[model samples]
Target: MELENIRRRKQELLVEIQRLREELSEAMSEVEGLEANEGSKTLQRNRKMAMGRKKFNMDPKKGIQFLVENELLQNTPEEIARFLYKGEGLNKTAIGD
Candidate 1:
């Protein structure tokens, strides 16, 4: 009878251990998924300067002409901002008024 009880207890312990192992596996899977999501979010959040775009193929005279045409030297802070964000439809007179 004692040997039978020991065997029953051993079976119960094995079942508990198996349940714990399954729980551990599920927890590890969840952690891996969360880590993967974090990695993607980090990549999206960071803005890295694009590679191979730092150099421009232009003459110095052309660069100065372009700046002059844009009135870069005489532009106000707001005007420069407007030019920078031209797609946003900002009014030149809207600022400092």
Candidate 2:
């Protein structure tokens, strides 16, 4: 009788251990997901802050002239404008002529 009771108790302990292991696995998955989400948010916030700090408000025409007068750029104004606005989805109208 005592042996039967010991076996039943062992079975119960095994079931409890399995339940704990499943709970731990789910908790670990949730932690990993939260960590990944936090990392992504941090990266986006950093990009936004960097972009906010780096402002290029120069007029394209004046910028081109300055570069040429300073001997800093050898390209023509048209070429410089094309280079600046290339792939930016902006047209010459945005530059006010």
User: Evaluated with TM-score, which candidate comes out highest?
Assistant: 2
RMSD values, in order shown: 12.4, 9.9
lDDT of the structure predicted as candidate 1? 0.50
Instruction: Report the lDDT tens digits of candidate 1 across residue range 20-42.
Output: 99999999999999999999876
Clashing pairs in 1: none
lDDT of each: 0.50, 0.61
Candidate 2, 1-97: lDDT as tens digits: 9999999999999999999999999999999999999999888765543332222223445545554554444567675655456524323453554
Q: Which portions of model 1 show Cα errors greater than 4 Å? A: 47-97
In candidate 2, stretches whose alpha carbon ends up further than 4 angstroms from where it belongs are 56-97
TM-scores vs. true structure, each candidate: 0.49, 0.55
Candidate 1 has a TM-score of: 0.49
Q: The CA-based lDDT of model 2 is what? A: 0.61
